[model samples]
Target: MRLSQAFQPTLKEIPAEAQIASHRLMLRAGLVRQTASGIYTWLPAGLRVLRRIATIVREEQDAVGGQEVLMPTLQSADLWKRSGRYDAYGPEMLRIQDRQKRELLYGPTNEEMVTDLFGSTVKSYRELPKTLYHIQWKFRDEIRPRFGVMRGREFYMKDGYSFDASYEEAGYSYFRMMLSYLRIFHRLGVKAVPMAADTGPIGGDLSHEFLVLAPTGESEVFYHHDWDLMDWGTSPLDPQKSEDLDALKEIVSKTYSATDEKHDEASWQNVPEDKRRSGRGIEVGHIFYFGTKYTEAMGVSVSGADGTAFHPHMGSYGIGVSRLVGAIIEASHDDHGIIWPDNVAPYRAAILNLRPGDESCDALCERFYQCDPEGLLYDDRSERAGVKFNDADLMGHPWQIIIGPRGAKNGMVELKRRATGERLELSVDEALAKVGLN
Candidate 1:
């Protein structure tokens, strides 16, 4: 992508309403634009990051036997009414009427709708352990939607529901999702601690919230320091093995982690003082086992082995797909701008023509850009060197390939790592090899 032709509207100053680092940087870096009080239009660069995060989420869900399905944004109020939550859900749910004056709602969550869909199709225990998920937009009508996408009223999310015939089977599905969330966060370059959380409106006795530690986070979280040292990848968790899943659950349960609402002072005192860690955290994912909450209310029962009617135990899992783009920035950025992780970055590297329009400089940058055109963003704009450098840092590609007149004359370029300002002057080929573009 050439900067000259790209639609990134970089700003020199921060927007007045952006309060946190992620919010401010998102505006200054031209990732998104506010279209309403709590709504935003994701620009091209922002959409790229959003799509990458959603892809990772989908892959992890699929690995754990989650089938992808598309669900509607607008839901029939009849489902909510049948679940006994039509009046209980409050103002967050946008209630409306269609042409025929029938009641409808913009779904804040999909629990009731999914239950209605699953109930209308399956009639026996054979389809018991099915999990369906969708990546789509959701709205919650926040009274005060600030902090950019972190707390936006409208945002993209990945929500999944699991149906099982018994409580024990539901717990296995819960544990499988817990492991999947850990793997997803690890791959996204953040250590997200799974903490016991109140189920809120989801109405579940068992719930876990995945929180990323950041100074600008909204909630206070307490955890054991051992979470920082443990390697999730090395854990013996096999999705196919029930014993392995149970073992994983045991490992997580023994760890002392909880949000402020669920924190137990007595339990905190049990841990060694040195191992106690407390900090502000941003919530990125949540999973819950609601058992028969929806199934019982909506009469979504199937025939049991004994020929008796039984409600399917169910669970719901959610990941803030759009919010993660901002959360990742909050966790990974420095003073310069967003330091996107390689796996989720819009472009792996930026090709900066330090002396744009100069024949040698242009040729050198062109060579590197062509080597991996799809993976590189070429800065071929008619901007000053200072502007180009500042913009490159502000955009925060994982690497920057610098092509200056002097170096380009000698067929050389400088490769700089974004996270750490490490620079190595080498030939164009060497630079490409360093960035894995060769």
Candidate 2:
């Protein structure tokens, strides 16, 4: 992607209504633009980042045994009625009427619809423990939607539902989803702690919210230092292993972690003062084990081994895919701009041709871009050095390969690390080797 040809419309001044760093930076970096009060149109750069995050979500979900499926954004009112939440879901549900005056809704979540789809297909316990997921757009119609995509009326999300034959089997499924969430955050370059959470409208006694620590977060949470040190490594998880999943759940659930709504002062006091940690956090993902809550209400039953019929226990898992773009910025940005993690960065490295027309500078940048054309963004615009530096920092590519006239003439370039203000002047080959672009 060349800056000269790219459609990113960066702003010189921050929008007055932009209340947070992520929101302001997103606009200034030309990642997104507001289309309405709570809706946004993701521009090229923003869409690239969003799609990369979705890919990571899909990979992790697949690893945990979830089958991908596409579901409609507009769901029939009959589906919601079957779950008894059509009226109870409140104004946020975005209820509407079609030409025939039949009620419909822009799905806030997909539990009811997924239940209906699964129930009508799977008919026996032999097909139990099925987890299906979809990445799609959802609407909530927030009365006061603010904070950019963080609390937007429309956003993209990855929502999944699991069905099991018994409560014990459901528990294992819950653990697998929790582990998957942790791994997703780990890969996305954030530390999201799982805390016991109220299911609220989700109607579940067992629920956990994954939150990323940030000063601008909406809620203050308390947790032990153990969460900071414990590592969810790159090892793969098998959802079918009940014993292993149960053990994994036990380890995480025992940790002292709670959000403000469920905070326990007594529990907080019990932790060693040095081990106690408190901070504001953004909720990025949530999982619920609402066994038979929807299946029973919707009359979704499967035949047992003995030929009797019973509702399968169920759980729902969700990750805010679009909101995560802002959440990542909130968690990782500094005063300059976003510091995108390598895994989800729109471009791994940017080739900044400071002296664009200089014979040596153009040659170096052109060669670098050719090496890994897809992973590099070439700044081939006729902009001043200061403007180029600022834009590169604002866009937050992990590495910036600066090819100025002076260095280029000497067959040298400067590699600048975005996260750290570290610069290394090396030959083109050395620079490529350092960034693994060779």
How well does each candidate superpose onto the true structure, as a TM-score? 0.98, 0.98
lDDT of 2 by residue, 224-253 (tens): 999999777654455557777867777766
TM-score of 1: 0.98
Give the local distance difference test score of model 1: 0.91
What residue runs in model 1 are displaced by over 4 Å at the alpha carbon? none
For residues 252-324, what per-residue lDDT tens digits would candidate 1 score against the true structure? 8788999999999999999899999999999999999999999999998999998999999999999999999
Clashes of 2: 0
lDDT, residue 162, candidate 2: 94
**Backbone clash numbers for all candidates listed:** 0, 0
Clashing pairs in 1: none
Clashes of 1: 0
